[model samples]
Target: MQACANWIDGGPQPSRADQWLDVTNPATGAVIARVPLSTAEEVEQAVQSAERAFADWGCWPPVERARVMFRFQQVLRDHFDELARLIVEDNGKTLAEAKGSVQRGIEVVEFAAGIPSLGMGDVLKDIAPGVDCEMIRQPLGVVAGFTPFNFPVMVPLWMIPIALACGNTFVLKPSERAPLAGLRIAELFAECGAPPGTWNVLHGTARVAEQLMADPRIQAVSVVGSSPIA
Candidate 1:
């Protein structure tokens, strides 16, 4: 069976984990692949990688960052059909549903590509005599996202593109049951010429998420799941 790998530092890497969980196709009882139950140390590595990249990535102008999103948008379009297929394979969504989900993800990327305008700060000239006030936006150092099994591609896209466009480095923990779409998307993002360590993915169970939430290095976290999981 195929073994899924983690995307770290702009490329795929074998997990250090000694244990793994099977990723089965929902439509059938077949084990399509195995995903690592990534260790806490591995999770830390992902966080540290994002933290290191933040120094440079966070300094990029919003327009330049948006340009990366634009390239990513194009790359996603180039592989649109493939992404839809991956979603169908991993999540067992119908071909039409998978296509719709992928399209929704692409739309988010399109919105992220416009962050140059959307993320602009505001300035108010002289409310009081000779005084001015301004609000400027800045990137937090590192952010993480936890996505559920359903709508794998769309959920991760909801967080990854916007966060990166806003200049925050990201570490994503995709659902163990359906992780391929997110991993493939990370590869496409790297091809868009994003710097190494700017985006990373780790596959595991809930413990990985706990590690993310407990870590001081993660400046923010986004989770899509049930109320208890949230």
Candidate 2:
């Protein structure tokens, strides 16, 4: 059994906790690894970095933003096997299901590159003489996403890249149970020219989620969890 890790700031680091949780291979019922239980403090650092990044990235040109998304789409497609293996190892899903989720995540990146159009605007009416009125869609600033274990790849796809494409920096609070898939997506973002602070991933339990939603710097949150979803 290896240690399931937490990635913070930019790279992997040891959990400060002496108390670690056993991550069993759900399919085999064997103790596959130990994942560090992250502290609330770590979560805050990741959020602060993302907020700082939002100041500049929010104003980045949409076409340039799309370029990053395009690079991510290619990287994920090329590394599909590694992604699927990690998903199956953590979540106990069948190989096919894992592959499907990766594919969908790729599609979301594709969607993001194209959704630049969402930011486009049309000048409706020209006022009298030289005066005119115009409107354009802009970024929503720093956004937060809380993803779930059931669909690790797909749920994050529904959140992170879209927020990035929309020109917002983000703090992604992925599920502790199956967080590696989310981490893999973060790597893709880094590869695609997403500046480190532009997209952040924090590993923890519910407290990590609360900190993100409660923070005044965060502009919005999209969470997917709970069976009935109240």
Candidate 3:
């Protein structure tokens, strides 16, 4: 069986973990791959990588960041069919549903590509006599996202593009049940010339998510799940 590796820094690395979770094709009972139950140290490494990248990424002009998103959107388009297939395999959704999910994800990327305008701050000039007020938007240091199995591709897309377009680096933990779609997305993002650490994928279980949430380096966390899990 194939073993999935974490995408840390800019590339894939096998986890030093002693345990893993199986990724089965939901349509059949076949085990397609194994994803590491990544160790806390590995989780820390992901957070640190995002933190390091944030220094430069956060300073990039919004237009430049938007340009990256533009490239990513194109890349996603180029591999649209393949992504849909992967989603179907991983999530057992119908081919049409998978395609719809990927399409919605691409739409989010399109929105993110407009961040240069959408993220612009406002200035209230001469509000009072000789006084002016301004509001400026900035990227938070490092952010993490925890996605559920149901919307593997679309959920991660919802978080990643906006965070990166706003100039923040990201670390994502996709659901252990269906990780391939998220892993492939990370790979395609790297291929689109995104700098290392700008976006990363760490595959693991809830323990890994807890580690990420507890870390001080993670400035914000976005999670999708039921109230008990949330």
Candidate 4:
């Protein structure tokens, strides 16, 4: 059942505040679990953690970050079954579709694991007299992502691993309709050697998503949804 009763952070009880949201299995329309809905204040705490993590995380060497991503990808594959189950239960997708969705998400980690290539630098040949020009890819401070219900695991992958590899810490806002799946990824990120505050998760609706985007702490925002919704 994933024990949505708690959110995963550096350890257990990842959420702050008294507000909570119930999770139902869209497939069967049964109450699956209860997830603590993080208030704006609580969300700020996560942003602070991620912001604090950025100073060092932004300086993390590409190869070192790649190592963590490697282990992360392997671990995700190790728990593929569990991840697939949650997707199917929460999304009401056929079990096979859920598994495929998770598989695609796992592949994103793999793609991101090649950080050296993914985090490429730019080169400029002789911008002036005997002066070599170049630009290095660096972290973009704290990035917040709002993942949609269509693909809980997949949407998060679109941001977290890539952003972390680029040395940017993350705050994830998963859809309230199917939120626990994003929280689960936070647990995996920690397990993957993502430093405390390097990644955080919160659940909510448009209000929460807007809160994330509007926060100055979040330097960048990735809103995932269909074109029509936008």
lDDT per model, in order? Answer: 0.90, 0.78, 0.90, 0.78
For model 1, residues 1-230, the per-residue Cα lDDT tens digits are: 88988888877889989999999988887999999999888888888889888998999988899989999989999999999999988999999999999999999999999988898899999989999999998888899999998998999999999999999999998999899998999999998877899999999988888888999989999999864443
Query: TM-scores across all candidates?
Result: 0.97, 0.89, 0.97, 0.90
Find the number of clashing residue pairs for candidate 3.
Answer: 0
Candidate 4 lDDT, tens digit per residue, 1-230?
A: 44452332365555565666678987678988766666777777777887778887888898899998899888888888888888887878888988898889888888888999878899999889999989887778998887888899988987788888888988877777787677777787787776788887766656667777778877888888854322
- Cα misplacement distance, residue 179 of candidate 1 (Å): 0.7
Q: Assess the local accuracy of residue 55 in candidate 1 as a C-alpha lDDT between 0 and 100.
A: 90
lDDT rank order: 1, 3, 2, 4
Query: What RMSD does model 3 have?
Result: 1.1
RMSD of each: 1.2, 2.5, 1.1, 2.5
Clash counts per candidate, in order, are 0, 0, 0, 0
Candidate 4 global lDDT: 0.78
Over the stretch 1-230, how does candidate 3's per-residue lDDT look in tens digits? Answer: 87999999999989889998888998897999999988888888888889888988899888888889899999999999999999999999999999999999999999999998899899999999999999999888899999999998999999999999998999998888899999999999998766799898898877888888888888899999754443
Query: CA lDDT of 17 in candidate 3?
Result: 90
Q: Evaluate model 4: give its TM-score.
A: 0.90
Give me the overall lDDT of model 1.
0.90
CA shift at 145, candidate 3, in angstroms? 0.4
Worst 10 residues of 2 by lDDT: 4-13
